[model samples]
Target chain A: MVRFIDGDTRVLVQGITGTQGSFHTRLMLDYGSRVVAGVTPGRGGMVVEGVPVFDTVAGAQDRHEIDASILFIPARFVLDPALEAIDAGLDPVVVITEGVPVRDTMEIVANARLRGTTIIGPNCPGIIKPGEVKMGIMPEQVFRRGNVGIVSRSGTLFYEIASHISRRGLGQSICVGLGGDPVVGLDFIDVLRWFEADDETEAVALIGEIGGDAEERAAGFIAGGGFTKPVAAYIAGRTAVPGKSMGHAGAIVQGDAGTAIGKIEALRDAGVAVGDLPGDVAEALGGLLKG
Target chain B: MKLLEHQAKKIFLDYGIRIPRGELVDSAIKAREVANGLGAVAIKAQLPVGGRGKAGGIQFADSSDDAEMVARGLLGTEIRGVEVKRLLVEEKLDFSDELYLGVVVDRRSRSYMVLASREGGVDIEEVASTTPERIVRHAVDPVFGLRDYHCRRVAGLLGYSGKEMFSLASVIERLYRVAWEMDAELTEINPLALTPEGFVALDARLNIDDNALFRHPDIVEALRLGGSSDLSPREREARDLGLTYVELDGDIGIVGNGAGLTMATLDTVALHGGRPANFLDLGGGASAEMIEAGVSFVMGDSRVKAVFVNILGGITRCDDIARGLVMARSRMGTEKPLVVRLVGTNEEEGRRLLESQGIPTLETMEEAADRVVSFMGGV
Candidate 1:
């Protein structure tokens, strides 16, 4: 009962000839993601790690069924391939590229909304279903099969927290990285809706950082009774200075908004266990799941 | 990158938006020369950040002598830590009323939101915090763009009617076009003065998206931003090296693979009573060379007593980080005592390489931060 993806979900590998693309495609395949086809313009006949490459997503779609597409293209060249994938009717297209121009992402997002397609990220690690399908670049060993649905804005923080969860004998049903950018396609509410509907997911761990009101809005949703699952969270950048982008472009405090303190309070007021440190997230989730 | 006042006015003029008759001058002599041409002028310091008007950065001059005096005082003076190198001399307008107009990308709507207000000539944030309902907003869809109806609605809310409504609507239309064409994150006119002729932008702020600058080659050539002067020399060098770094007032320099993790590392270090010297994210998919460069850069900071490198390798391989650690140690040596935390994705090979180089490694971020603080002799 994975929320977004599972073993049967066929994956499409965009930029299959590129170094990072080829490497991650093989890893995803090895993790049993069922990567059926690859697409890289003008490299149709190429075979990357036993995955047949096509000239375009349409060409690959014609030959083999592709449920979702994972992009490993560079930032500058990513917009076209992403639009092509979305136009080709691929749902939940994951853009693993970092540093994509915001305007280009706007165009992609608008197009996706028009097509009713779900785009995961432009600067994020993709999604993963533990012990079934790994559609992202997250290390496989840190995750174990269980019923906890994890979603985060930061990739490494999620990894740090997920490892702690794994160590505490808690496993995950699915983990999703919504990306750390000023604007992203998927929001916390979108993932939470799916998590609430997922019977296998008994609990959720949300990893949020400073910048943006996603966490606050997610808390609002929870407080409004949109989700009933036991939830815990860790908000980073508690001591971040105002008007400074801390690593991620989206992780900045502007005026009085998007502060870690504000987010923690919002989550806590909504009856969500909020943690102070990375390890505290695992502990909070452990406590919530037990309760 | 935030465009200075003169730059924003230049872009606004390009979009056919009405602006005060002005010229940007570097010296007092030039300012006087411009003021002589346009009597009763306003001398404003050209800066990227806001809050200048209250900080004495903006002053009125009735005569050319007063203009020169004000310009002399403003030039080479630091406003908000930034030295004002230029001044914009403009003909002061006698307006009956002032209004506000702005466009910013709204995160919730995932679209550009055009904000208009009847109350102007003051801080918009203050008005937003205080009066709240004084501000009117219209979300502009990128596909349909800013339509005539949206502008009219905003103008009507601002107490405009009939001819005045359409007149103000055109300015909003032009500003919205400027925002879209420039790939601007924020475009603002704090006081859209309603003069006898029409509305004129007394001040303008256009913050373009840095990532979208590649598409606007003309702006890149004309602006020549050359990175921000606000960045420290070390920070500028870090930017040049493609590492995201933020300088801090601490002795423990910190580095990590991702932004969220790096910030968390900073918090954790501070929690352990260690003041972090800087924030350096190597980015996801960081190579061995990048790691070496980032490590060398952080260690180069003379004020930094110790360095903490926390890499929870996922896509960023631990072996690559270890190799970089080995290279950095061989090249720069261990001038700053460093703590390395490596995990996941070839963790063994990475740990072995770092350990063989005699650089001790920790397992968790807590251990890494704690060890580095201890290296500061229990600071």
Candidate 2:
């Protein structure tokens, strides 16, 4: 199997009756993902696109073997379902819902950690393994099967960089959007570790943005030889400033870290090749893998 | 959203935390009346940003007349580019020590941290840079919260002893309660003055998490009562329209489908020798109508020489963007040049649509950036 999932991986869709949920559910099934069951509280007895819907994660699990779960619930009601999936022993709880409260996210993260399960996003496009398991909202045509492993903070960046590499005749083995929220389940470090151990991934392309020490910490991990694979990086928001609304605490919390320039310098210091723009990623990643 | 100093102090008063006796006033008459009762006061301009003390936003007045004069001088004056319409008139505290106390979310620990230091009333970042050892850090468990032992440990690190130590611990506990209950991203009491009376939060800074506003109806009400005075008219409109638009001093206006891509578009525009007038993200799967609104909003800016629409359409369809581009051009009635870069979903169909409409749609961000920058020289 690819690092996270494969075509045969049994999937569970939370909030399967909703518009976006039903649409992506059909998309995943069409892409050969084994989306066996779905959960939609009151709409349990109904069938969506031939997939049986259950009221609870436990009820869905009782009928079918579920490997992973994707959340498409409303922001106000997302936490309970996310926690239910985690409690039901789902390995990767992919939350596609946006606007989840930071407090709820903190609780979910803490719970996931306690269970030793992986929770991908509170506001993110989920993961995809190209032609294999498209357990995400990303379109399938631009991506093909290849060697580069992609991990990004932003969804569109993931698409742009991956499509750039694919157009250059190289494709991704796995591309993970780690969400655009404050705290996420997996960071650059965790994904890099996965890529280092993944035999399919020859090189890695990383996309970062302003407003966190995630990149700096990833740099530290790479410098310490935590992940031996070649990495090509791009930090968005080079001309970006800390959001004025974010206040002094964000700056005080991170004294000299989290700046785009700071992250670039750190990545450079760690010997990772940093791209100047989105299009430079595929070219730099090609160079990195070759040399 | 960040709370003004007076709002934060009001919350502090609601909790058991001690704060300087103060009231928020917009007029100099009210400031004089408050100062008359308090005798000596600190007329602090209630701005959303920090570093106001050094910027002369905080003024000292020994008498009510001086307070009125200081209030008149501070009101309507801009501090760090934000006009101050209100002031926090408070009784100045006489203190022996000015210690730093703050609670903030620590992404590294995946928990909240209580930061304490003997050094305060200055830049905490400067303190962190110059003498990081002076700052004591304690990670609080989200479930258990800030425990008694944890607070006591912090108080001891700040050089407190016996009853004062316990009192300081209680203060920290109360502050933690405020942070946890209020869904605060940051809670700070810089210069938590250890007066002969007790530990008074001389300056209160509170930033509530924007996402958690759904839970705090009280805070939502407070926010409604206190309009978003910090945002400009355009920015306020952008907020209502669900677009993330940040104004910049440049000639090119950028519109994109996501935050990261939008930011990269800005950087790419700058890299190709283009200056971006603003950062506008239309978000994922933005409809043709939303794009029209976004582009129209940016074109409304007289300083913009050209507009660049960058769409990497994983979920966002390029045809929708192309349709929106034509709509924006027709609706705005502006002659500003446009650059469109489309990739991912429905790329070719959208490009064909734009080409047929006489809008040149480029395939790469680099080429689009180059073309947009060239327009800045003329057209």
Candidate 3:
């Protein structure tokens, strides 16, 4: 019932034997995620940190009941692993690899949507539910079991807010880094929709950066009265260089459309409290929930 | 990853699309020779950025001498911040109508979208804003190839019929294929001129994905040669180290873990009345070597009076960043004031690591920004 993942969710680690995959696999397991198996094409017989390795998601599915799969493959090889997991019926697939080609991501996202699967990120820090499970590469210590549902486009920025929230005794229910790529798996609206239905999530915090119109669309969704949870928003990159992509693929100003001020105004019109800075988010969310 | 016009046209020709016959030359003498060979010619500046025509980077010549003269006038000039080292001498085409055709990555739909517009030789964004209905967009299903019906719908929308419609449809299909095969974020033929012979591409633009450069060796080679000519030396050096760096007009050198955090840091600095010298994202799970490389690059900027290290470690460990700061100081011998803010994932140990080295670490982003701006004596 907790959005996307819970304690009982069995996870399959893609690219399990690789440097990033194996490293985060240990962290996810330590955080109490039910990681059942691992997948590395040529390292089928290998055992990474006591998790059984398979050649493919199909092979991993033979022995364990995997609810979702997390991809840690390199950017160049992300599409194949993602498609393989999707083809094997992995419902909620998470891609953590950065620098995935936009075309390849388009194909993967299109294919995933046609197959009715949820993809989290292509260049994002994954999801973490405190006292339950951690899927991607979020720092576990910053998270504590609480009621705020956190979703963001940036990874480290999410941790900054999460740490601030946790330190102030306002813990998160689930924090999802939807990724910084232009074409991500779950956007602000999608995650917001899930948060609205989850009873455990009392409020939501959306950390959006300058770039695409996803934030503007989220503002529209909130204006439609679809989400009832008190939403606290922070749009980064107010001083971002125009027309230049600030690291992330999705974080760029086209002309006048995807500016921070525009997104902040749109969200404010929808009754969402917007923070002036990253540090102000916790106080903003606290004020919104109290009101 | 925006390709020069000549490079884009080469790809267009490779895909069997007709383009105005052109030759790229650096010298005015060669330009004259080429223009004479082609008869009447147009001298277009070779730059990846837009607005060349409005910026006087394009000119028409009725004779070879005129072409050479125009080329000489433009050869040593800068257009859109790019040096006009090369010019494209192309045969001027006589076209009756101008149309727009492009294949763009539609992020909202999570698909590749092909857009065709009857109105061309103008800003497509203007058309999108003022009259969106003039543009016809068809989201191509990646599973199935670009269907004839899809092309026909776009062609019909552009007001083409019969043989012209079919020809335009084929052009759209080819553009989509080229975009797909080349991993282009945007491949556009603005003002697909309707010459008496057929639809010839008058101007072409192709922006390939930098992340997908592994698949395109030609682009990688081009990038090495001059694809990054727009980037400053510091930015180019950072690129060589596999780091994301954008030079800005500011004094505080800022480096951080993720894009959002990096940008937020920049804003935080600006809020405190201190300008940021550059934008540097060390990325997740960065090593000491990466930190060293990132910090050194930012420090290398002459405009940077101070360095601000902002780390909100998620998968990125702060202790590693501390070691990197230490390593960077040793390697670069920087005397500039360093303000470090470490939080999340081994934050205490990271702070301890910095404190042991006599470097003061701040607790919050606000505190770090305020202290740095104060250290710089305000903007």
For every prediction, compared with the true complex, DockQ reads 0.77, 0.55, 0.82
The better-scoring model by TM-score among 1 and 2 is: 1
lDDT (Cα, tens digit) per residue for candidate 1, span A49-149: 99999999999988998898999998888889999998999888999887787777887888888888988987888899999998789988999989889
Instruction: Give me the runs in candidate 1 sitting further than 4 Å from their true place.
Output: A1-3, B225-228
TM-score: the better of candidates 2 and 3: 3
Question: What would the C-alpha RMSD of candidate 2 be, to one decimal place?
Answer: 2.5
Per-candidate TM equals: 0.97, 0.95, 0.97
Question: Where's the lowest-lDDT run of ten residues in candidate 1 chain B?
Answer: B222-231
**Candidate 1 global lDDT:** 0.89
Error of 2 at B362 (Å): 1.1
> Each candidate's chain A: what TM-score?
0.97, 0.94, 0.97
Candidate 3 Cα deviation (angstroms), residue A150: 0.8
Instruction: Show model 3 residue runs off by greater than 4 Å.
Output: A1-3, B226-228, B332-334
Q: Write the per-residue lDDT of candidate 3 for residues A224-276, one digit (tens) a residue.
A: 98788898888899888788889998898988879998999999999888888
The backbone clash count of each candidate, in order, is 0, 0, 0
